[model samples]
Target: MKFTFFTALILLFAPLTSYSLSQISNPNYDPELAEKLGADDYGMKSYILVILKTGENTSINKEMRSNAFVGHMKNINKLVDQKKLIVAGPFGKNNNDFRGIFILDVSSIDEANLLLETDPAIKEKYLKAELYPWYGSAALSEYLESSDKIWKVNP
Candidate 1:
Protein backbone atom coordinates (compact mmCIF):
# COMPACT_ATOMS: atom_id res chain seq x y z
CA MET A 1 0.00 0.00 0.00
CA LYS A 2 1.30 3.49 -0.94
CA PHE A 3 0.97 6.24 1.69
CA THR A 4 0.03 9.77 0.57
CA PHE A 5 1.36 12.96 2.18
CA PHE A 6 -1.92 13.38 4.07
CA THR A 7 -1.80 9.77 5.30
CA ALA A 8 1.80 10.25 6.51
CA LEU A 9 0.87 13.43 8.38
CA ILE A 10 -2.13 11.74 10.00
CA LEU A 11 0.00 8.83 11.17
CA LEU A 12 2.62 11.17 12.59
CA PHE A 13 0.05 13.16 14.60
CA ALA A 14 -2.22 10.34 15.75
CA PRO A 15 -0.04 9.26 18.70
CA LEU A 16 0.41 12.81 19.93
CA THR A 17 -3.35 13.44 19.83
CA SER A 18 -4.08 10.27 21.78
CA TYR A 19 -1.33 11.02 24.31
CA SER A 20 -2.72 14.50 24.90
CA LEU A 21 -6.19 13.09 25.42
CA SER A 22 -4.87 10.45 27.84
CA GLN A 23 -3.10 13.12 29.90
CA ILE A 24 -6.34 15.11 30.19
CA SER A 25 -8.11 12.00 31.46
CA ASN A 26 -5.23 10.58 33.49
CA PRO A 27 -6.04 7.45 35.45
CA ASN A 28 -3.24 8.19 37.96
CA TYR A 29 -4.73 11.55 38.93
CA ASP A 30 -4.57 11.94 42.68
CA PRO A 31 -6.89 14.45 44.36
CA GLU A 32 -5.32 14.06 47.81
CA LEU A 33 -1.83 14.81 46.50
CA ALA A 34 -3.17 17.85 44.62
CA GLU A 35 -4.72 19.23 47.82
CA LYS A 36 -1.53 18.59 49.78
CA LEU A 37 0.57 20.50 47.24
CA GLY A 38 -1.95 23.30 46.76
CA ALA A 39 -2.20 22.34 43.10
CA ASP A 40 -4.88 23.75 40.83
CA ASP A 41 -6.68 21.64 38.24
CA TYR A 42 -3.54 21.71 36.13
CA GLY A 43 -1.31 20.65 39.04
CA MET A 44 0.27 24.08 39.16
CA LYS A 45 0.36 26.97 41.67
CA SER A 46 1.63 30.50 42.11
CA TYR A 47 5.09 31.35 43.43
CA ILE A 48 7.48 34.28 43.66
CA LEU A 49 10.54 34.27 41.43
CA VAL A 50 13.43 36.38 42.65
CA ILE A 51 16.34 37.39 40.45
CA LEU A 52 19.43 38.49 42.38
CA LYS A 53 21.78 40.88 40.68
CA THR A 54 24.99 42.75 41.43
CA GLY A 55 24.08 45.76 43.53
CA GLU A 56 25.36 49.32 43.46
CA ASN A 57 27.54 48.69 46.51
CA THR A 58 30.41 47.29 44.50
CA SER A 59 32.83 48.11 47.25
CA ILE A 60 36.22 46.40 46.90
CA ASN A 61 36.07 45.57 50.59
CA LYS A 62 36.83 41.84 50.47
CA GLU A 63 36.05 41.11 54.11
CA MET A 64 32.65 42.79 54.01
CA ARG A 65 31.70 41.10 50.73
CA SER A 66 32.81 37.72 52.06
CA ASN A 67 30.84 38.11 55.27
CA ALA A 68 27.72 39.17 53.39
CA PHE A 69 27.87 36.08 51.16
CA VAL A 70 28.37 33.83 54.17
CA GLY A 71 25.26 35.31 55.70
CA HIS A 72 23.51 34.88 52.36
CA MET A 73 24.13 31.14 52.36
CA LYS A 74 22.98 30.79 55.94
CA ASN A 75 19.84 32.76 55.15
CA ILE A 76 19.15 30.46 52.19
CA ASN A 77 19.41 27.39 54.41
CA LYS A 78 17.14 29.01 56.95
CA LEU A 79 14.53 29.78 54.31
CA VAL A 80 14.75 26.26 52.89
CA ASP A 81 14.25 24.84 56.38
CA GLN A 82 11.20 27.04 56.75
CA LYS A 83 9.89 25.69 53.39
CA LYS A 84 9.75 29.22 52.01
CA LEU A 85 12.38 28.86 49.27
CA ILE A 86 11.75 26.07 46.79
CA VAL A 87 14.77 26.64 44.55
CA ALA A 88 17.97 28.74 44.67
CA GLY A 89 21.04 28.87 42.46
CA PRO A 90 23.64 31.15 40.97
CA PHE A 91 23.83 31.78 37.26
CA GLY A 92 27.00 31.59 35.24
CA LYS A 93 28.56 34.78 33.81
CA ASN A 94 26.01 36.53 31.65
CA ASN A 95 25.56 39.89 29.90
CA ASN A 96 22.39 40.63 31.90
CA ASP A 97 24.51 40.96 35.08
CA PHE A 98 22.17 38.45 36.70
CA ARG A 99 23.89 36.82 39.68
CA GLY A 100 21.39 34.29 40.97
CA ILE A 101 17.74 33.20 41.20
CA PHE A 102 15.32 32.03 43.84
CA ILE A 103 11.94 30.35 43.32
CA LEU A 104 10.17 31.25 46.53
CA ASP A 105 7.10 29.39 47.72
CA VAL A 106 5.36 32.54 48.80
CA SER A 107 1.95 33.91 47.94
CA SER A 108 2.97 37.40 46.91
CA ILE A 109 5.89 39.61 45.91
CA ASP A 110 5.54 41.52 49.21
CA GLU A 111 6.02 38.33 51.17
CA ALA A 112 9.06 37.42 49.08
CA ASN A 113 10.53 40.87 49.67
CA LEU A 114 10.00 40.50 53.40
CA LEU A 115 11.93 37.23 53.37
CA LEU A 116 14.71 38.71 51.21
CA GLU A 117 15.15 41.44 53.82
CA THR A 118 16.55 38.75 56.11
CA ASP A 119 19.38 38.05 53.65
CA PRO A 120 22.50 40.04 54.49
CA ALA A 121 23.52 40.23 50.85
CA ILE A 122 20.31 42.03 49.91
CA LYS A 123 20.05 44.01 53.15
CA GLU A 124 23.62 45.25 52.97
CA LYS A 125 23.29 46.24 49.29
CA TYR A 126 25.80 43.59 48.20
CA LEU A 127 23.04 42.13 46.04
CA LYS A 128 19.71 43.37 44.70
CA ALA A 129 16.56 41.25 44.64
CA GLU A 130 13.89 41.53 41.94
CA LEU A 131 10.72 39.59 42.51
CA TYR A 132 8.10 38.43 39.97
CA PRO A 133 5.02 36.29 40.17
CA TRP A 134 5.44 32.79 38.69
CA TYR A 135 3.16 29.86 37.98
CA GLY A 136 4.78 26.39 38.13
CA SER A 137 4.36 22.77 39.10
CA ALA A 138 3.12 22.36 42.67
CA ALA A 139 5.37 19.32 43.19
CA LEU A 140 8.50 21.38 42.60
CA SER A 141 9.51 21.34 46.28
CA GLU A 142 9.14 17.58 46.57
CA TYR A 143 12.45 17.20 44.69
CA LEU A 144 14.27 18.90 47.57
CA GLU A 145 13.99 15.78 49.71
CA SER A 146 16.06 13.82 47.19
CA SER A 147 18.35 16.78 46.45
CA ASP A 148 19.83 16.72 49.94
CA LYS A 149 20.81 13.09 49.57
CA ILE A 150 22.51 13.57 46.20
CA TRP A 151 24.89 16.27 47.42
CA LYS A 152 27.80 14.51 49.12
CA VAL A 153 29.52 17.69 50.29
CA ASN A 154 28.06 21.06 51.23
CA PRO A 155 29.15 23.84 48.95
Candidate 2:
Protein backbone atom coordinates (compact mmCIF):
# COMPACT_ATOMS: atom_id res chain seq x y z
CA MET A 1 0.00 0.00 0.00
CA LYS A 2 2.81 2.43 0.91
CA PHE A 3 4.73 1.59 -2.28
CA THR A 4 1.64 2.19 -4.42
CA PHE A 5 1.06 5.61 -2.84
CA PHE A 6 4.74 6.58 -3.32
CA THR A 7 4.69 5.46 -6.97
CA ALA A 8 1.53 7.49 -7.62
CA LEU A 9 3.08 10.60 -6.14
CA ILE A 10 6.23 10.25 -8.27
CA LEU A 11 4.25 9.73 -11.47
CA LEU A 12 2.00 12.70 -10.77
CA PHE A 13 4.82 15.13 -10.03
CA ALA A 14 7.44 13.88 -12.49
CA PRO A 15 6.06 15.73 -15.50
CA LEU A 16 5.69 19.02 -13.62
CA THR A 17 9.19 18.63 -12.12
CA SER A 18 10.76 17.87 -15.47
CA TYR A 19 8.85 20.64 -17.19
CA SER A 20 10.02 23.18 -14.68
CA LEU A 21 13.59 21.94 -14.87
CA SER A 22 13.60 22.11 -18.66
CA GLN A 23 12.16 25.61 -18.81
CA ILE A 24 14.78 28.32 -18.50
CA SER A 25 13.61 31.92 -18.53
CA ASN A 26 14.70 33.61 -21.72
CA PRO A 27 15.35 37.32 -21.91
CA ASN A 28 14.19 37.43 -25.50
CA TYR A 29 11.14 35.24 -25.07
CA ASP A 30 8.25 36.70 -26.99
CA PRO A 31 4.90 35.06 -26.31
CA GLU A 32 3.20 36.76 -29.20
CA LEU A 33 5.84 35.70 -31.67
CA ALA A 34 5.81 32.18 -30.30
CA GLU A 35 2.05 31.95 -30.63
CA LYS A 36 2.21 33.33 -34.16
CA LEU A 37 4.77 30.68 -35.07
CA GLY A 38 2.73 27.86 -33.46
CA ALA A 39 5.41 27.18 -30.88
CA ASP A 40 4.91 25.07 -27.79
CA ASP A 41 6.32 25.83 -24.37
CA TYR A 42 9.78 24.95 -25.67
CA GLY A 43 9.46 27.16 -28.75
CA MET A 44 9.55 24.03 -30.86
CA LYS A 45 6.94 22.14 -32.84
CA SER A 46 6.41 19.00 -34.87
CA TYR A 47 7.27 18.70 -38.53
CA ILE A 48 7.62 15.98 -41.10
CA LEU A 49 11.12 15.47 -42.44
CA VAL A 50 11.13 13.88 -45.85
CA ILE A 51 14.27 12.32 -47.21
CA LEU A 52 14.07 12.01 -50.98
CA LYS A 53 15.90 9.06 -52.42
CA THR A 54 16.60 7.87 -55.93
CA GLY A 55 13.74 5.69 -57.08
CA GLU A 56 13.95 2.36 -58.89
CA ASN A 57 12.44 3.64 -62.13
CA THR A 58 15.49 3.83 -64.33
CA SER A 59 13.68 3.22 -67.63
CA ILE A 60 12.00 6.64 -67.71
CA ASN A 61 13.01 8.67 -70.74
CA LYS A 62 15.29 11.67 -70.24
CA GLU A 63 12.58 14.14 -71.24
CA MET A 64 10.06 12.62 -68.85
CA ARG A 65 12.61 12.77 -66.06
CA SER A 66 13.38 16.38 -66.90
CA ASN A 67 9.72 17.28 -66.94
CA ALA A 68 9.10 15.56 -63.64
CA PHE A 69 11.93 17.45 -61.95
CA VAL A 70 10.72 20.72 -63.40
CA GLY A 71 7.33 20.01 -61.87
CA HIS A 72 9.11 19.05 -58.66
CA MET A 73 10.81 22.46 -58.36
CA LYS A 74 7.61 24.27 -59.14
CA ASN A 75 5.76 22.26 -56.53
CA ILE A 76 8.47 23.13 -54.01
CA ASN A 77 8.00 26.83 -54.68
CA LYS A 78 4.27 26.46 -54.33
CA LEU A 79 4.60 24.71 -50.99
CA VAL A 80 7.01 27.33 -49.70
CA ASP A 81 4.63 30.06 -50.73
CA GLN A 82 1.85 28.27 -48.88
CA LYS A 83 4.08 28.09 -45.77
CA LYS A 84 3.81 24.31 -45.70
CA LEU A 85 7.42 23.60 -46.51
CA ILE A 86 9.91 25.22 -44.17
CA VAL A 87 13.07 23.87 -45.77
CA ALA A 88 13.92 22.06 -49.00
CA GLY A 89 17.33 21.29 -50.44
CA PRO A 90 19.23 18.71 -52.43
CA PHE A 91 22.13 16.82 -51.00
CA GLY A 92 25.58 17.04 -52.57
CA LYS A 93 26.97 13.97 -54.33
CA ASN A 94 27.32 11.24 -51.75
CA ASN A 95 27.40 7.45 -51.55
CA ASN A 96 23.99 7.43 -49.93
CA ASP A 97 20.99 7.30 -52.28
CA PHE A 98 19.54 10.43 -50.66
CA ARG A 99 18.69 12.97 -53.37
CA GLY A 100 17.09 15.74 -51.36
CA ILE A 101 15.13 16.63 -48.23
CA PHE A 102 12.06 18.59 -47.27
CA ILE A 103 11.15 19.71 -43.79
CA LEU A 104 7.39 20.05 -44.00
CA ASP A 105 5.55 22.10 -41.43
CA VAL A 106 2.92 19.46 -40.80
CA SER A 107 1.90 17.40 -37.83
CA SER A 108 1.26 13.98 -39.29
CA ILE A 109 2.80 11.59 -41.82
CA ASP A 110 -0.55 11.52 -43.61
CA GLU A 111 -0.46 15.27 -44.15
CA ALA A 112 3.14 15.14 -45.36
CA ASN A 113 2.34 12.31 -47.76
CA LEU A 114 -0.57 14.27 -49.13
CA LEU A 115 1.63 17.31 -49.71
CA LEU A 116 4.36 15.18 -51.27
CA GLU A 117 1.85 13.80 -53.73
CA THR A 118 1.77 17.23 -55.34
CA ASP A 119 5.39 16.74 -56.43
CA PRO A 120 5.60 15.07 -59.83
CA ALA A 121 8.99 13.57 -59.06
CA ILE A 122 7.56 11.55 -56.20
CA LYS A 123 4.29 10.74 -58.00
CA GLU A 124 6.08 9.59 -61.17
CA LYS A 125 8.56 7.47 -59.24
CA TYR A 126 11.55 9.65 -60.12
CA LEU A 127 12.05 10.08 -56.40
CA LYS A 128 10.90 8.18 -53.31
CA ALA A 129 10.07 9.88 -50.03
CA GLU A 130 10.82 8.54 -46.55
CA LEU A 131 9.06 10.53 -43.89
CA TYR A 132 9.92 10.94 -40.25
CA PRO A 133 8.62 13.09 -37.44
CA TRP A 134 10.93 15.99 -36.64
CA TYR A 135 11.10 18.53 -33.81
CA GLY A 136 12.64 21.87 -34.66
CA SER A 137 12.56 25.49 -33.65
CA ALA A 138 9.26 27.14 -34.63
CA ALA A 139 11.31 30.16 -35.69
CA LEU A 140 12.63 28.21 -38.71
CA SER A 141 10.04 29.76 -41.03
CA GLU A 142 11.31 33.23 -40.13
CA TYR A 143 14.47 32.50 -42.14
CA LEU A 144 12.53 32.33 -45.40
CA GLU A 145 12.03 36.08 -45.56
CA SER A 146 15.79 36.69 -45.41
CA SER A 147 16.52 33.75 -47.69
CA ASP A 148 14.34 35.19 -50.41
CA LYS A 149 16.24 38.48 -50.23
CA ILE A 150 19.72 36.92 -50.36
CA TRP A 151 19.14 34.50 -53.22
CA LYS A 152 20.34 36.48 -56.27
CA VAL A 153 19.50 33.57 -58.55
CA ASN A 154 16.37 31.48 -58.36
CA PRO A 155 17.18 27.79 -58.17
lDDT (CA) per prediction: 0.95, 0.94
Deviating ranges (above 4 Å) for candidate 1: 1-23
Instruction: Put down candidate 2 lDDT per residue, 1-155, tens digits, no spaces.
Output: 56798899999999999998997899999999999999998899999999999987796499999999999999999999999999999999989899999999999999999999999999999899999999999999999999888877876
Model 1 error, position 69 (Å) = 0.3
Model 2, position 4: C-alpha lDDT score: 90
* Top model number, TM-score: 2
lDDT of 1 by residue, 43-84 (tens): 899999999999989899999999999999999999999999
Q: Could you tell me every candidate's TM-score relative to the true structure?
A: 0.84, 0.85
Clashing residue pairs, candidate 2?
Answer: none
Against the hidden true structure, what lDDT does model 1 obtain? Answer: 0.95
How well does candidate 2 score on lDDT at residue 52?
98
N/CA/C clash count, model 1: 0
